[model samples]
Target chain A: MSRYLIQFAYDGGSFSGYQIQPNALTVQEELEKKLSILAQRKIEVVGSSRTDAGVHASQQFAHFDCPVPIQKDWVYRLNRMLPHALAVISIEQVADDFHARFDALSRTYHYWIVRKKTPLRRHDTYWFEAPLDLEAMNAACQILFQYIDFECFSKVKTDVFTFDCTIQKAIWTEEGDFLKFTIQANRFLRGMVRAIVGTLLEVGEGKLKPEDLHQIIQSKDRNQAGRAVPAHGLHLVEVKYK
Target chain B: MSRYLIQFAYDGGSFSGYQIQPNALTVQEELEKKLSILAQRKIEVVGSSRTDAGVHASQQFAHFDCPVPIQKDWVYRLNRMLPHALAVISIEQVADDFHARFDALSRTYHYWIVRKKTPLRRHDTYWFEAPLDLEAMNAACQILFQYIDFECFSKVKTDVFTFDCTIQKAIWTEEGDFLKFTIQANRFLRGMVRAIVGTLLEVGEGKLKPEDLHQIIQSKDRNQAGRAVPAHGLHLVEVKYK
Candidate 1:
C-alpha cells in the first residue's frame, strides 16, 4: 500500500464536524468519498485535527493509504469535484508508515475577535461589543507557559488518555479592529482552544486578573474556568509535521 | 412626513438583487419590511444603485419617507432583526424632497479578480486562470476617457434614458494576488461595468488592441462589445451624493 498526504482548507460552517458520522455531513466523509471515487475503491482517510462544527481550517492535513500509486493529476481533478466549502490545496506521497493524526510536531490555532460587525465576515469572526484590554489579555498569555496539563480547559465528558500538552506559543496580537489569539501546542484536549480563549477574555474584560489564569490552571477543574466561546471564531491554522 | 437617508452594506450573495421581485428575496424588500416594523407604518425606500444578483455593496444608500420620526436606537434594533447577509450601518434625517436615485453625484464600482482560490472568498471573487497583461488593461482604461456614449457596453433591452455617462475615474490596481478594477462615474447603465471589464480583459489577453475600444464605442452595438462578466465579482463600493 502507498501512503499519500494532503494539505487542505475548509469552511467548517458547511459541515457538522471533521469526523464522519451516520446522518450528518462531515469533512472527512466528503474527502473519503471523493478519494474513493478517484481510487475506484473504498479509501478511508485519517485527519490530523478533528475540528468541531463551525470551526474553520486554513491549513489541515490528512493521510490515506491506497493499494495503487495515486495519479499525478489527482489534485486538480479532486478539487474540481469537491464542494464549495472544501478544497484540496496540495497533495504529496509519504512513507508507507506515515500517519496523519499521530504526527511529530505542534498544531496552531487562531481565534478571531472582531470589534466591528460586517456582513461579509459574519461566519468566521466573533463580534465582541465590549472594549477589550489587550494588555491584560497578553499578560494572561504569559501565565500559560508554566503549565502542561490543561484539564481545566478541556470539555467535561471528553475521552482522552492524557491531559498533558506541551505549550509552544500563546499570544494575543492586535490586528486593527480584529484581535487574534493564536496558540501552538504539541497536542490539545477536546474543547481546549475555545475554553482557553473564553477564559482569557475574562482577563481582557476586567472580570479576571491576569494572574487569575495561574489559579485556574492549578485547579484542574473545568467548572472553575469560563464557558467555551462559540466554535465559529476558531480556526486550525496549521499542523506541523517532520 | 420625514425623509431619511441611510447607508448600509450587504453580502449580496444571499439576495436575488437590489430590487424587489415577486417570490424572490431582495435587499430593498428586506429593508422595507424591517423599516416598516420600526416606524410602525408602511415605508418605502428608493435605492441609489440597482445592483444585479450576487453583487456586493460596501457602501450603498437609500432614502425613505416615514410618517413618524425614526427612533435613535433603530440602527441597533434593525441590525438585530436583519439577516446575516445585510446590515443597516447608519441612518440620518434628510430634506423632505431628497431622493436616493436622482440626487446621487457619482457611483464607484469595483470588480475583484483572484489569481488563487481560497475557500473563504469563493462567493465574492472571480477566479481567472488566464495570464492578464495589466499594462494593456490600464491602457484600455485610458481609452475610456475620450468616450461618453458607451451603448456598446450597455446590456441590450436595458431601460435607460441615455447611454452617455461622465467617466471620472477608471483604473486597475494590483493588491498582492488580487486585481481590483475601480471605476467612478456620474452614472452607469445596466451591465455597463461588466461589459467594459469583459472587453478590457480581451485587451489584456492580447485578443484585442487597446485603441479598438474607440470603434466599439462609436458602433453603439451591444454585440460589438465583449460579453458581460459574471455579477459575483462586482461590488458597488460607494455612491457619492450631494
Candidate 2:
C-alpha cells in the first residue's frame, strides 16, 4: 500500500459541505467518487478542512492510501474527471503516517465583506450596507488573542470534545472595496470563524464594546455572543502541515 | 419627456448578448421588461456598448426616455428589481439630444488570461495553459496604433458601413495571476477586441512577429487574422461620453 497527498481548491457555493451526506451532494463525496473510479476500487479521502456550504477554498489538502501505484499525471486526470467547482492542483507520495486532519499544523480562514453591491462578486462577498468602524473592529481583534476557549463562538450541539484552540494570527485589513478578516489557529470548532467575525462586526457597529468580548468568551455560552455571520462570505484559505 | 442616462454593471455569463433578440433573453430585454413594470409604461433603451454573449461589463451606459418623473432613489429600486446578474450604479437626467451609443467619445475593453487553473475565477478568466511572453505581446501592441482599418480583426458577417476606427491605447500588463490586455478606441467592430487579443497571443507564442500585424491589417481580409478568443474572458470595462 502507498499513501499520497493531494492539494486541491474548490468553489463551495454548489456543495452542501465538505463532509459526506446521505442525500446531499458534497465535496468529499465527489472527490471519493472520482478517486474510486480512477483507482478502480473504493477510495476514501481524509480531508484537512471540513468547510461549510457556500464557503470557498483556495488551498486544501487531503490524503488517501491506495493499493495501486499512481502516475505523475494524476492531477490532470483527476481534475478532468472531477466537477468544475473542484480541481486538484497536485498529488504526491507521502509517508504512511501523514494524516490530513490530525497532522495539520494550522489552518487559516478569510472572511470578505463589501460595503457596495456589485453583480460580479455577489457570491464571494457579504454585502454589509452599514458603515463599520475599522479601528474598533481591530481593537476587538486584539482582545481575542488573550483566550484559548472559544465556546462562545462555536455552534451548539457539535460532536467535538473541546472548544480550546490556540490562535496563531488574527488581523483585519481593507482590500480596495473589501473589508477582509484573516485568522489562523491550530484547530477550529464548528462555525467558529463566522461567529467571531459576526461578533467583531457588532463591535464595529457600536452595538458592543471591545471589552464585552472578554465577558462573552468567559461566559462559555453561545447565547452571550453575537450571531454567526453568513457562510457565503467565509473562505478556508490555507492549511499548513509540518 | 425626460431622457435619463443610466450606468450599470452585469455578469454577462448569464446573458445571450446586450441587444434584443426575437426568442432569446438579452440584457436589453431584461432591463426593458423591468423598467416598463416600474414606470407603468412601455420603455425602450439604447445601450452604449452592445457586449457579446458571456462578456462582463463593469460600467455600461444606457439612455431611456421616461414619461413620468423619476425619484433619485431609482438606482436602488432598479437594482432591487433586476436579477442577481445585473446592477444599476447610477441614473441622471441628460439633454434631449443625448444618445447612449452615438455620442460616446471612447470605449475600453479588458481581457483577462490566467495561466493557473483556479476554481474561484473560472468564469471570469480564460485559462491559457501555455507560457506567454509578455514583452513580445506588448511589442505587438505598439504595431496596432499605426493602423486605421482593422478589417482583418472584425467579424465576417457584420453590417457596419465603415471599417475605420482610430486606436487610442493598447497595452498589456501583468495583474496577479493574469496577463491583462486593455484597449481603448473611438469605436470597435464586432469581435474586434477578442481577435486582437488572439493575434497578440500568437505573437507571444512566437508564431508571429510584431510587424506581421501590419500586413494582416493592410490585407483587409478577416481570414488573415487569428481566431477570436472566447467571450467569457472579455469585459467592457468603461464607456466614456462628453
Candidate 3:
C-alpha cells in the first residue's frame, strides 16, 4: 500500500464541517468521493484537524493509503474534478508511518474584524460598528500567550481531554480597515479562538479592562469569558508538521 | 422639502441589481420600501451608480427628498432595521439641486485576485491557479491611463452615448497573496473595469503581450477584448463628489 499526503484548500461556507456525516455535505466527503472515483476504489481521508462548521481553512493536510501506486499528476487531476471553491494544492508520497493528523506540530489561525462599515466585505469579515481600542485589545492579547490552560474559552463537553495549549504567538495587527488577530498554538480546543476574540473585543470596546483578561482565564469558567465571536471572521491559516 | 444624501453599503450577492425590476429584489427596492414605511408615504432613492447583480459597493451614494426634517439618529435606526449585509454609514442634508448621479466627480474601483490555489477565500477574492507575471500585468495597466475611448472594454448594447472616459489612476499591487487593482476614473462604461482586468490577466499569464493591450483598446471591439471578469472580484471602493 502507498500512503499519500495531500494538501488542500476549501471554502467553509458550503460545508457542514470537515468531518463526515450521514447525509450532510462536507469537505472530506467530497474529496473522498473524488479520490474514490479517481482511484476506481473507495477511499477514506484522515484530516489533521476537524474545523467547525462555517470555519474556513486555507491549507489543510490529509492522508490516505491506496492499494495502487499514485502518479505525480494526481494533484492536477483531482483539482479538475473538484468544485471551484475546493482545490487540491499538492500531493506527495509519504512514508507508511507518516500520518497527517498524528504528525502535525502546530496550527495557525487568523480572525478578521472590519472596523469600518463596509457592505462589500460584510459576509467575509466581522463588522464592528463601534470604535475599537486596538491598543487595549493588544494588551489583553499579550496575556493570552502567557497562559497554558484555556478552559474558560473552550466549548463545553469538548472531546479533547485537556485544556492545556501552548500559545506560541498571539498578536493583533491592523491592515487597511481590517483588524487581524493571528494566533499560533500546538492545538486549539473547540470554540477557543472565537471565545478569545470575543473577550478581546470586550477589551477593545472598553467593557472589560485589559488586566481583567488574566482574571477571566484564571476563572476557568466558560461564563467568565465573553460571548463567542461569529465563525465567518475566523480562518485556519496554516497547519505545520515536523 | 429637504434633500438628504445617504452613504450606503450593500452586499450585492442577494440582490438582482441596484435598479428596481418588475419581479426582482434590488438594493433600491429594499431601501425604498423601508423608507416609505418609515415616512408613511411613497419614497424613492436615486443612486449614484446602478451596479450590476452580484457587484458589491462599500460606499455608495444616494439622494432622497423628504418633506419633513429627519433626526440625525435615523442613520443608526435605519442600520438597525436593515440586513447585516446592508448598512447606511451616514446621512447628511444636501442642497435641493444635489443629484447623486450627475454631480459625481470621480469613482474608484478595486478588483481582488488571489494567485494561490486556496479555498478559504474563494468568495471573498478571485482565485487564479496559474502563476501570474505581475510586472507584465503592471506594464499593461500603464496603457489603460493613456486611453480615452474605451469602447473595446464596454459591454455591448449599452445605452451610454459616450465611451470617452479619463482614467486618472490604474495600477496593480500585490499584498500578501492577493493581487489588487485600483482604478479611478471620471466615468466608466458598463463592464469596462472587468473587461480591462480580464485582458490584463491575459497579459499576466503570458497569453497576451503587453504591447497588444494598446491595440486591444484601439480596436474598440468588445469581442476582441478578453472575457469579462467575474463580478464577485470587483468592488466599488469609493465614489467622490464635489
Candidate 4:
C-alpha cells in the first residue's frame, strides 16, 4: 500500500462543510467518491481542517492510502473529474505513517470585511457598513499574543481537550476598500478565528476599549467576548507541515 | 426637469446584457424598473456603455431625467431596492446637454488571464494553461498607437459610422498568478477590445509574430483578425468626461 498527500483548494459556497454528512454534499464525500471510482475500490480520506459551511480555503491538505500505485498525472485527471468549485492542485507520495491532521505544524486564516457595497465581492467579503477605527483594531490585536487560553473565543460545545493555543501572529490591515484580519496559530478551536474577528471589530466600533480584551481573556467566559462573525468571509489560507 | 447622473458597478454574470431584451434580465432593465417604482413614474435611463453578457464593470455611468427633485439620501435608498449583483455608488446632478454615451472623453478596459487554475478567481479571470510570452505581446501593443483604423478587429455587422479610434495607451503587465492587458481609447467598436486581446495572445503564444499585426490592421478585413475572447474576463474599469 502507498500513502499519498494531496494539496487542494475549494470554494466552500456549495459545500455543506468539510466533513461528510449522511445526506449532504461535502468536500470529503466528493473526493472519496471520485477516488473510489478511479481506483476501483473503496477509499477513505482524512482532511487537515474541518472548516465550517460557507468558509473558503485557498490551500488545504488531505491524505489517503491506495492499494495500488497511482500515477503523477492523477492530479490533472482528478481535477478534470471534480467540479469546477473544487480542484486538486498537487499530489505527492508520503510515508506510510504520515497523518494529514495530526502532523501539521500550523495554520493561517484571513477574514475579509468591506465598508461599502461591492457587487464583485458580495460572496467573498462581509459587508460591514459601520466606520472602523483601524488604529484601535490593531491595538486590540496586539494584546492577543500575551495570553494562551482562548476559551472565551471558542465554541462552548466543542469536544477539544484543551482551550490553550499559541498564537504566532495577529494583525489587521487595510487594502483599498477592504479590511482584513489575519491570524496564525499552532492549533485553533472551533469558531476561534471568527469569534476573535468579531471581538476586534467591536473595538473598532468604539463599543469596547482596546484594553478590554485582556479582561475578556482573563475571565475565560464565552459570553464575555463579542459575537462570532459569518462563515462566508473567512478563508483558510495556509496549512504547514514539518 | 432635473437630469441626474448615477455611477454604479455590477457583477455581470447574472445579467444577460446591459441593454433590455424582450425576455431577458439586463442591468438597464433592472435600473429602469426600480427607478420607475421609486419615483412613481416611468423612468428611462441611458447607459455609458452597452456591455455584453457576462462582462463586469468596476465603474459605469447612466443618466435619467425626473420632474421632481430627489433627496441626497436616495443613493442609499436606491441601493436597498436593487439586487445584490448591482449597486449605485454615487449620484449627481448634471447639465441638461450632458450625455452618458456620446459626451464621454475616453474609456478604459482590463482583460485578465491566468496561467493556472485558482478557485478564488475562477469567475473573474480566464484560465488558459498555455505559456505566454509577455515581451512579444507588449511589442505588438506598441504598434497600436500608430493606427487609427481598426476595422479588422471590429464586429462584421456593426453599424458604426467610422472605424477610426485613437488608441491612447496599451500595455500588458503581470501580477502574481495573472496577466493583465489594459487599454484606453477615445472610442471602441462593437467587439474591438476582445478581438485585439485575442490577437495579442496569439502573438504571446508564438502563433503570430509582433509585426504581423500591422498587416492585420491595414487589411480592413474582419477575417484577418484573431478570435474574440470571452466576455467574463473583460472589465469596464473607467469612463471619463470633460
The model with the greatest DockQ is 2
Segments in model 2 whose C-alpha atoms lie over 4 Å from true places: A37-40
Which is the better candidate, 3 or 4, if ranked by DockQ?
4
lDDT of 4 at A152: 97
Off by over 4 Å in 1: none
Tens digits of per-residue lDDT for model 4 on A1-242? Answer: 99999888888887988999999889999999888888899999999999988889989999999998887778878887888778888988999999999999899999999888898888779989898898999999889999999999999999999999999999999898898999999899999999999999999999999999999999989899999999989999999999
Clashing pairs in 2: none
User: Sorted by TM-score, highest first, which candidate order results?
Assistant: 1, 2, 4, 3
Residue-by-residue lDDT tens digits, candidate 1, A90-184: 88989888998897498999999888667788889887868779899999998898999899999989889899999899999989879899999
Of the two candidates 3 and 4, the one with more favorable TM-score, higher being better, is 4
Ranked by DockQ from best down, the candidates are 2, 1, 4, 3
RMSD of 1: 2.0
Candidate 2 lDDT, tens digit per residue, A1-242?
A: 99999888888897998999899989999999988888999999999989988889888889999999987777778877888789898888999999999999999999999877787788888878788889998899888899999999888989988999999988889999899999999999999999899899999999999889999999999998888898888889999999
TM-score pick, better of 1 and 2: 1
- Candidate 3's residue-wise lDDT over A125-238, tens digit each? 788878789899989988988889999999997888899999998889999989999999989999999999999989999999999988899999999999999888888889
Pairs that clash in candidate 1: none
Q: Highest TM-score, which number?
A: 1
TM-score of 4: 0.93
Candidate 2 CAPRI level? medium
